[model samples]
Target: MIDPSENPELWDFLSSLHSGELLTGTIAAIEPFGVFVALDDGPDHPLFPGVGFITYPELSWTPFNEASEVLHVGQRVSCEFLQFDTWNGEARLSLRATRPDPFQLFADGIEVGQELQGRVTEILTFGVIVEVADGIEGLIHVSELAGTPCQGTQGVVRPGAYITVVVTGLDRQRRTVSLSQKRTSKGSP
Candidate 1:
């Protein structure tokens, strides 16, 4: 769907690209929301400097505190084309897609009732997010966090503090893990 009335050359160029295809580009800009790529084979964007774009979550398969920790401006990279971003007139790209998905690689055999040790990454009023595995963050709902006492808990869960939790649920398609601090066996790892 090329808007030929606009930048016909740009639209035509993007129209030819397909999902899952590998595209090479340089990191043109990094914003808090996403990273921009100036694709080697793509036309100049009328607004953004690059026609290829990657959101924060697509930057890596590893856990990163910030996008700059994983990627940098001017760095060359090969990303998988996800789709044409019609709203932004850009190609939605995935840097992590070029790499193996950690969830699919590791979560296939994970079962409920498994105990895991993870560092608390975020604390919300509803629950805390923990990383039981690299790139995998799951929620310990407030209901699940109740009645669990830990050295790290001084009446509250704090980020970067370690906690043991039991797997309560898994959504493979969504790549989310549900955990319960209350269900974990008393032990430390």
Candidate 2:
């Protein structure tokens, strides 16, 4: 078998790449899990069609139903090198890292006690997750779901249902925003 190390061209090309370097590539294929990119300035990957790969979450900051919604084959894209995935033998790339974080923008304009309308995206045993904006989700804990103590989240809220909630806490460091649905007549607390 021919060893990759024996190919000085491929070896030197791969050795020159470093994490956090910016790269340009064309979308070679779109998959459910990620997008394969044929790098314009890098050696061809032995296992994949392209030398760079972007995972689903790395495609964009906005939530998308399909990879095609964010990228198409032959499309040129700029990505940040996350790491060399030794297991997959591909360069782990992040397209979103090259763009501004939407969560940080959302957090900047929001404050505690501010009211916002959102759709329930998920219901967990501990709380209900609401999408206040594109890709922005906040949790309404079971205790904050109602004025009175509740037994469970089943009857409280369902997925796809729209609800108004007041922000109770914000942890920018953790990228978490705590919301509450319970409100008194005056909306003081």
Best by lDDT: 1
Which residue segments of model 2 deviate by more than 4 Å? Answer: 86-89, 157-161, 183-189
For residues 48-153, write the lDDT of model 1, one tens digit per residue: 9799999988888777888999889999999999998887789999999888778877678688999888899998767889988876889987777854444233
The positional error of residue 27 in candidate 2, measured at the CA in angstroms, is 0.7
Q: How far is each candidate from the true structure, as Cα RMSD in Å?
A: 4.2, 3.1
* Strongest candidate by TM-score: 2
Name the 10 consecutive residues with the lowest summed lDDT in model 2: 180-189
- Please provide, for model 2 over 1-189, each residue's C-alpha lDDT reduced to its tens digit, 9 standing for 90 to 100: 225565556556656789889999999988777899998898877767787789998998888899989889999999998886655556779999999998999999998889998899999998899999888999998888863465568777779988888999999889898988885233322
In angstroms, the error of model 1 at 127 is 4.6
